[model samples]
Target: MKIFNTPSNSSTFTGFILLGFPCPREGQILLFVLFTVVYLLTLTGNGSIICAVHWDQRLHIPMYILLANFSFLEIWYVTSTVPNMLANFLSDTKVISFSGCFLQFYFFFSLGSTECFSLAVMAFDRYLAICRPLHYPTIMTRRLCTNLVINCWVLGFSWFLIPVVIISQMSFCGPRIIDHFLCDPAPLLTLTCKKAPVIELIFSVLCPLPVFMLFLFIVGSYALVLRAVLTVPSAAGRRKAFSTCGSHLTVVSLFYGSVIVMYGSPPSKNEAGKQKIVTLFYSVVTPLLNPVIYSLRNKDMKKSLKKLWGT
Candidate 1:
């Protein structure tokens, strides 16, 4: 398949201007403050989770370790757009250079994709814990968890290499303006002079299919886990089972629901508002909520935090 349409004549794009939210000056300032607060919270929450997991030996289980990795990725994920977005909100113009744009997409997609696969791994972990309780330790061993984490990073990095290389070949001419706060794939592609049909097709195929499959796997795994929990004779046993899996499900619902909506559909100009809202849920809000979701609901995490802080 043709990676990118050949330019009628090769010309380097000077730069791309990002046409962000059409808000009044007051609205822009408000957005900056809102996002600034969110970014700070995201950093602190994820950073705290990472440090707690690292320093507390009692919290060194596979689940917390996975959470630590997710925390680190969340830091990078929010950083990719929030800083540039803050700058855009403060300035009159929001123009990003071609190299800068590509780099933004690289980090955004890389971290996002890793999180996608990481969620699946977490679901599988819960499945082993609840559905096959006796084999949880043997099956979800330390080596296996390490390998899964490594796979998430490697797969996320490799997934975008082809797409970025292909985008590099395409030429961007005049009207170098992008819609939205960041150099996202959909908004940026609309500005390209080259026929982006192949790029679109690649996105069309790569975007939704894996998410749908993973969604199905998560549903099936949880279904079995629920069945196992129901079989527990004692109320305490059932309560314990539910507590273990409840936070994971809550986070999965929040992150996956917003993410699937944003990337799972074809690009459209009209969906800009919807896109921004969903992006907020997945990118900014979810990270801030994750530690809270896990810590408040999980007894182990609460105990560990109490011990870690000597409270």
Candidate 2:
């Protein structure tokens, strides 16, 4: 892939343009309203879950702590994507400065990485709960949970730092148009004047490897969990066993499903629209799904929420 550039080396760009929300003028207004409603709900729903989890002493176990982390992550995760997207939808020109673009990419990738790692941690938490029931309390201590959350942020940032640094070095003197709503790595790579095959390859590897590892961990954890659940002997015990993990599995499926669709294959024009749909899936829809799945699916969460709301 030859990085095309018609200008001399002195040519530089002030900012990269984002041709985000490619709908008509009337459509932009509708999208702004729609996204605003969704954003507010995301904040409220995820925020309520966090508050409920914190206030209820009975819900302060490792599972709810992980659920709180998921809720907190969902708040930032949707915030990272929707605010910029909403602004672009409402703005006349969807232009972001180079520094601004880099900053956006950093937060977007950081939050995304945190979500991935948090899901993996949640899976491990479930695995220990189901497979090693007697030792679960001793194994997942409060200090351990704090360390895991800290490690998630660290891992998420570290994973994206290399690609962001590489992108920073590349010059974008040509066309400034970006196809997507935000300053994502793959689409922004299309604008660079330098041949970034190496960068592309690096990103290809970076993108899928962690996801694959997480997929394996989730699968392995759930498999063991299912096997353990089946051995419970009593029919009611099996239903009770599934209730504990059903919500987590639903969230895991929604997030990883969107991710696999968006990044698993090579990028194309046809795929771009679908990718955007899946992008909304992971960003907007999944965050919305988190509280719904957790609250409706988990009896404990529902009771905690009821008490918190004085219902």
- lDDT per residue (tens digit) for residues 46-147 in model 1: 887888889888778898898888888889989988898888888886777667778887888778878888888888998898888798899988999999
lDDT of each: 0.81, 0.84
**TM-score of model 1 (CA atoms):** 0.90
For model 2, the superposed segments whose C-alpha errors exceed 4 Å read 1-12, 265-269
Q: Which ten residues in a row have the lowest lDDT in candidate 1?
A: 2-11
**Clashing residue pairs in candidate 1 (N, C-alpha, C atoms within 3 angstroms):** none
TM-score of each: 0.90, 0.94
Those runs of model 1 whose alpha carbons end farther than 4 Å from true positions after fitting are: 1-12, 263-269, 306-311
| Candidate 2 lDDT trough over 10 residues, lowest sum | 1-10
Model 2, 94: alpha-carbon shift in Å?
0.9
